[model samples]
Target chain A: MTKNDLEQLIETHGNEIYQFCYHLTGCREDADDLYQETLFKAYEIRKKIDKSDVDSPLLKERNYVLGIAIRLQKNLYRKKSRRKEELLDNEQFEYQTELASDFNTEEKVEKDQILAYLRKIIHSLPLKQRKVIYLFYFADMSVKDIGKLLRIPEGTVKSRLNAAKNALRIKMEEKGYE
Target chain B: MNNEEMIREALKLNIDAPEEINEKVLRNAKHKNQGVVFFKVATLAASFCIMTIVGTGLIVKASTGKRLIEYLRGLIDNRSYVYENGTDTIMTVYDNNGEKWEHVEYLDDEVTMSHPLSENETEYNLYLKVTGENGMEHFMNVTAKVNEGQSSEDLYWAIRGDFYRFFSPYTAADEKSQILAGLKEAADNADKDFIRDALIDVSADLENNRRILYEDWPADIWGGEGRYIFFEDLSDLPVGKCIIIINTVYDDEDSFIFEINIDGNQLYVNDVSFNKYSEEYYQEQLEKNLPIYDLR
Candidate 1:
């Protein structure tokens, strides 16, 4: 691939790809590493990607990066677990927060609490379940695509997504959120 | 906002990619490109074939055997059934450390009553007292009410509000198809408001929030209740099974030890120790003592 192609891919999908990495690892530090590795891998195999393979440029970009990420994550997880199983169990992850001044006080407070609860719920899910949730909700991927990337069936993807949502519902109910 | 919107909004936390990451990836890519040398076509083709063979072997290895997630998935029973005549449900749970304790829930007679109420419109407040050996007690109150003749689907919706209640003799995916079919009927109608009103009249406790929201509602949204929140037999758990206890609160001062085992088709939590108590002594005492209540 040309320098122009590389720059274009990064400029188009960098934030989204990074967000996927962040949700997968559930820690900013790990997400940074995974994101960097994913970009480098994409660059290495850029020549294999056919620009005209699909109609949507955005979809192609996402597919390329996510495909690399899924494999990288699986390999990294096995290696990490062999050394130490409890990767994120002991460490505390600080979620980045930004206060938007446009909203009124009451609206802002309500929104913030909901966001906090949801974030906590997401963070608490098992790593595999969290990945499915992030791809379905945040990445807006179809079930088929998620299945293909994860090398699982569509039923399994739906099953994991369902489990993640149920876990969230339980947490939310405990906190008095209907 | 609806669930989809709520989810999208909740996932909106701002993430700032580190400046170093961009610098590192581009630098490595440039170096790799510069170091590349022209290779003969025949040599390149040979290398590709060899790499493919090795890659295929690795992929096959990765696909073999049980994955960690699969084992974890089977940990929870898709559906648990308590005898209709039984008034109590008991199970054992385990902590991350493999300690076990018996957990018992005594459902009041009214709660376990299988007979329908005489009145066309009647309600019952199903009361349960769940107590652990660690002196932790939880009171559960589930409202089970019916208007007119009740369908099985309506009964499920009433209990789904509580996760623990939802798991009682849970329905498997295959069994849940009938419920989805029922919901699908409701979805077929073009008048969302009409169906919503009808649903409210039938079972106000129904958990069909998503069904009423979208015309082409996916079945998984409704399938979630049965698909998740299951009870697996303790005997089915692998030997030396351990689980992690996620602390809901930020503070770790009140952490409790939990462990589980299975016997006679009933699950039990054999050990529970509070931080304030002597864990070793407590565990020793538990091994000698019989369950507080042996309904079986």
Candidate 2:
């Protein structure tokens, strides 16, 4: 919980947490602010984090930091959409305007469409299911890791992931995508 | 790209953070005393507990109460027996606020000129779009399958079961004739008695739900999960093979004609499009079910 420990946590896990926040918010600006907020929040309560498990210090720290980010993201979402019950209002879901790669080719165009559809479906998902999906699929986190980060049972994480997958499949099918 | 691949690609976009994030974190952490930190942590923990308890309560209520059944029914009721070019049909449910509760595409095409539902595979996925209590729409895609495969004798009962699931919560006792007209329109010579019995069951179920819930009969309850219909008589009703033609009538509103051969005779069942069958239609049909149009 010292300043040195905080600096090390940021250096080692900061980018990962940043990625998590970016996917959670689906916007870079929000991610940056949330990333900083999460680090500070984690540092504030660093003394309370269960530190007895010396076998996985980084893992413990990652969970603590990511947990704060997720809660903050939920709070932000609730605040943003308090007037409307829609879980992911269109205004809150801002995608990057520029694609990461060039997409002048036909194949890339198709890929872009599919990816956009995927993003829409992901954003369409309920908050809980969306979190599990982003962490598992986008963040490349293991189900066990996600369960720990979300503070839920691993089985619950698995179920939520399955539900999200099924819902996505149905939506993709609706759009004539197998 | 597949979902995982697409997500990986999306997440791969390097997210830039402000350079001053480190300084901000250090300053905020330094400003927080041990007591303040403890207080914030304690407050967060308490909030989490309250959220969990309230969430669990809502989930339990939704699952066991009207919400779950309404959601389940929305999935099933959106299905229709119609010819698709060997292509899947989809059903999407949306709440009043235009938020989708369920979107189920890739439903197995179970209809042809001859067979409406496959005898081999009774399992069918229904896409439901429902508006939740908050007026936001929810979507669900659920499989409607009975474990035991149904025989032709079970078809009427199955149809009746579906009818009950579809209408009981929505249609009142006085509106029984509308259901009869609709069913009669679907299958000509539909036994008035059989249809009446199903209607009565629906009304009874609605009454029971109203009594138990101690609330007014929610209009949303009509199509949902609680329908498990069983007709005592195992005797098969007479149904003959006849060419059935389905066409939408655009000139006189978006009504549909379900023309079928019944008992070596042509029968016509025409009414408003099932998709548009709403509270307004319920009221309209209360006076007189729409007149049938004969194409044969």
Candidate 3:
């Protein structure tokens, strides 16, 4: 892919990519760093990709970017774990209160509270389960696609999804959310 | 909303990338485009030089009647070897003062120095040979630690270099300065929990398939021998007691623990210990042919 093609690709899928990073990291600072690294790494990889392969469908491109993001995020987590960096804490939830100004007070408050709880719970899930959940729910990917991306059996993907959903359900019910 | 709907809604929350990142990415793309040609040329030139050097080295070795060192299949980092039985065995080729020694771990305990070499002489009967410049050869028999359970002292030598390198980046002056700055900020804010939490996070991260225990420093642990010491001079500061118990990722038998003392803002590691596990557990794992851990 040429520079212009990459620019166009980023322009089209940048938000989704950034959102994926945000969900993976649970913090804006880390998300920003991860997103930038993902884009740059994608660019570097794209340069080596065959020109004929560049014309593949937009969905393939999206998957390609997400794949790079997943690997980069995993590596980042491993490095942070090795360094014994500070854990992701309550500070990530600080932005939940700053939701869209368009929503009315009660609606906004309820939405913010639910989102804060959901994010914290999701963040606390094991990395494998969290990845499946993110790909399935946020990225709107199929079980087959997630399996292909993660290099796991489709049954494994479904099981991880089920496990993640069950955990979320338990946590939500405990919070009195129906 | 139902559970799935609630999850979908939470995940679908609209989040936008920061505008600065977009601009930075575009700038980087433009810069990369300019440098691509140069990078390709430099890479080609470097590859050519490497090929020439390798070609010359191989020719010289062939002319000198020196045997080429052939590593076993599935050798990783010239240290660990993966057996077909799914065991991640530690096979280190050691060079000590021109004397070459190979430490190879086998899956079973039946193989020993006295065991007869198989007919093929390929799979079994591996030997560590030291060759002098004059082509004088000395053969040494090296045994797998699985046969005779590894001692703590043996594990200390085997794993300390890896542990040291893993944590060496944090020992740099700039890294220490950064850590101290963060610690001082937390200290000034009286966030002792943050300091302790940070340490706990470190402990939790390193506790992958390994047990970590916080204990008091015992003088008998190191026996006054401080050869593997990372940090020694912390006599001036008040140090808190925090010890990390590390099970060797290589084998299940040995447990090594080191104490980390937090003195004001500085962190000092004092004393080391290696404790052995029950022989039964080691033998059971061997009999089951189970991989201790997946290094991949």
Best by TM-score: 3
Per-residue CA lDDT of model 3 for B199-228, tens digit only, reads 334333233212222222111222222122
Which pairs of residues collide in model 3? none
lDDT of 2 by residue, B205-250 (tens): 4444321101111111222222222222111223432222122211
Clash tally, candidates in order: 28, 17, 0
Give me the TM-scores of chain B across the candidates. 0.20, 0.21, 0.19
lDDT of 1 by residue, A55-165 (tens): 476566676587677656644543342132334422223322454455557667676677767776776676667778888888888999888666568998998888888
Could you give me the TM-score of model 3 versus the true structure?
A: 0.45
Deviation in Å, model 2, residue A177 alpha carbon: 2.8
Every model's TM-score: 0.43, 0.41, 0.45
Error of 2 at B277 (Å): 66
Q: Report the alpha-carbon TM-score of model 1 versus the true structure.
A: 0.43
Q: After superposition, how far is residue B153 of candidate 3 from its true place, in Å?
A: 30
Please provide, for model 1 over B114-201, each residue's C-alpha lDDT reduced to its tens digit, 9 standing for 90 to 100: 1111122223223223332343332333333333343334333333322222222213443233233333333343143432343343
Clashes of 1: 28
**Candidate maximizing DockQ:** 3
Selected candidate, larger lDDT, 1 vs 3: 3
Error of 1 at B177 (Å): 59
